[model samples]
Every structure is written in C-alpha cells, then in structure tokens.
Target: MSDKPNLEEVTSFDKSKLKKTETQEKNPLPSKETIEQEKQAGSS
Candidate 1:
C-alpha cells in the first residue's frame, strides 16, 4: 500500500518534469539579436 502511493507520486512528478522540458524545448526564448531589433524598432 505505501509502495503503491510512493510509486504513483514518483511517476507523476517525472511526467510533469518531462512535460516542462519538452515545452521549453519546443518554444525557446528570444535571442539577443531579436531583442535589439525590437528595441530599435520601438525607438523609431
């Protein structure tokens, strides 16, 4: 009984961690060049 709950918790945590990693990989943050271009456009 105790082992079952522990295993379920571990599996759920791992799935969440993997999902976060995949999301980050799919949608990366903007780069420095992109930021600079945005600033330049805004100033103009």
Candidate 2:
C-alpha cells in the first residue's frame, strides 16, 4: 500500500479530532437519474 493519504483517511483523522461533518467539505457525485437526464439531453 502507498503511504499517500486518501481522502477518507484524512477526513477520518479530522473526525477523530471532533470535526463537524457539516463544516467539512463533502464530495458530491451526480445521481444516476441526473446523469441519465444529462445524457438524454445531450443526445437530443
């Protein structure tokens, strides 16, 4: 395994320090519905 830090590891470390979830930046991904909608729109 690489020594490089993963986001989950870094974020978990912060949580151990009592960091608030709401205050932390979240990684958002497009939902399947939204992705399909965009694809359909583009293909039109």
Name the candidate that leads on lDDT: 2
RMSD of each: 7.6, 9.4
The TM-scores, one per candidate, come to: 0.42, 0.42
- TM-score, candidate 2, is 0.42
lDDT of 1 by residue, 1-44 (tens): 45445565665675544544333476889999999999999999
List model 2 lDDT by residue over 18-43, tens digit each: 75555654788889999999999999
Inter-residue clash pairs, candidate 1: none
Measured with C-alpha atoms, the lDDT of residue 44 in candidate 2 is 100
What's the C-alpha lDDT at position 8 in model 2?
81
lDDT of predicted model 1: 0.73
CA displacement after TM-score superposition, residue 33 of candidate 1 (Å):
0.2
- Supply candidate 2's per-residue lDDT for 18: 71
